[model samples]
Each structure stands twice: as structure tokens, then as C-alpha cells.
Target: MNTILIIANLLVLFTFIIHTFGGDKNLKAIEPEQDSPKRLRIFWTMSRGAFHIVSIDFLFATIGLALINFTDYFQESKLLLNLLALYFLGYGIAFLLTLIISKKFSNIYFKMWQWLLMLVIAGLIYWGNS
Candidate 1:
């Protein structure tokens, strides 16, 4: 269970690193047409803001999971681990509710991946406590 959590955290860390470093390039690939400069600026700001939130959250999760697994290496904070789990569960539920209400997604693949991630976090938190 610990190993699983470690692996999950590593994957999330990798994802955050990719998004934080390659945000511009990745966003460029999916850039949508805008009618005016103002619209484009708004779109970019929203996109980057979203990316920043996800990246920062994942960064915290990665660190928290790492500390949970290797308590001696870093200051282990049960509160942090619990908070991370709650964050995962909340985001997962939010995603599910959003899909249920709208039946639409900016990226279906990412949504599915998030579900898997939520499950892993849930598993880790449940088993870690037991």
C-alpha cells in the first residue's frame, strides 16, 4: 500500500512538473480562436490560473505522500496527509458532479484519469490508517 501511494505520488509529481514547465507549449497546442485580443487574454489568464491551481495542489500532494511514506526523511504531518486525501476526494466528487450535470468535458481522457487518481488516493488513505 505504501509503495502504491509512492508510485501514485510520483506520477502526479511528474504530471505537475510537465504542466508547470510546458504550460505554454501545451496550451498553444490547444489554443482556441478568439475574436479579439481581450478575449484571448482572458482565455489565457483563465487557462493559466487553472493550471497553476492544479499544479500547486499536486505539488503539495506529492510532498505529503512522500513524507507519509518516508517519515524519517521529512517531517511527517498527519494533518497534511489527511488534507491531501480530502482534497482528492473533493475534487473527484466535483468532477463527477460536473460531468453528471453538464455531460461535457474539456478533455474526457483527463477526467477519466482523475477518477483513477482519486481512487488511488482513497485507497492509500484508507489502507494507511488501517
Candidate 2:
């Protein structure tokens, strides 16, 4: 589990580094329907939306350290690891909720992709841990 967490954190960091550097975003595909300002706004929103996942992922990865450190802090600490699991579950819920309720990001392809990917990630993590 310690190794799992270290790897997960590393993966999150890698993802953030990739996005922060503007790597491989499919920006050319989305088109504005009518108003140029609206188009610009959507483009901006989509562009920024990609970074939020990295931020959240990095945060969770930081928390994953508790799985390692907590055992030393308190002997026989399985609950700390359990909290990490709940963190993932809660994060997933938050992502799903944002996906459903964020009207500002509506009609944006990036948000849709973010929402779907988060849910999928949540499921995979849950299943993998279970």
C-alpha cells in the first residue's frame, strides 16, 4: 500500500507537470457557434478546466503520504489508510457533483471529459482497492 500511494502521487505529479506545460490539449477541435466572445469564454474555460484535475489529484496524492507516515505516528494505524480510501471516494463524488451542477462549464467539451474521466477514475480506484 505504501508503494501504491507513492506511485499514485508520482503519477499525479507527472500529470500536473504535463498540463502546466500545455502538453497535448485538443484545443483546435472545439468551435464557436455564433458569438466570438462566447467562443473565447468557452475556450478559456476549457483550457483552465484541464488544470483543476491535476490540482485535485496532486492534493490527494499529498494526502496519500498519511498511509505511510501515520503508521509511524501511531502504531497499527489502518484507519489512516482507510481515510485515504474515503478521500478518493469523496473526491469522486465532488467531481461527479461538479459535472452535474456546473452550468458555467456547460456546453464545454473539456468539462464533459473531465467529469466522465473522474467518474471512471473513481470507479477504477474503488474496484482496485476493493
| Best-performing candidate as measured by lDDT | 1
In candidate 2, which residue pairs clash?
none
lDDT agreement of model 2 with the native: 0.53
lDDT of 2 by residue, 25-111 (tens): 543335444566876877766866765665665555555544453346545345644555566557567766776776665566464
Model 2: weakest 10-residue lDDT segment is: 22-31
- Per-residue lDDT of model 1, residues 24-92, tens digit only: 577777676665577787888798788788888878778777777777655545566666667777877
Find the candidate with the highest TM-score and give its number: 1
Stretches of candidate 2 above 4 Å error? Answer: 1-3, 15-60, 63-77, 104-130
- Candidate 1 matches the true fold with a TM-score of 0.69
Q: In candidate 1, how many Å is residue 45 off?
A: 1.9
Clash pairs detected, candidate 1:
none
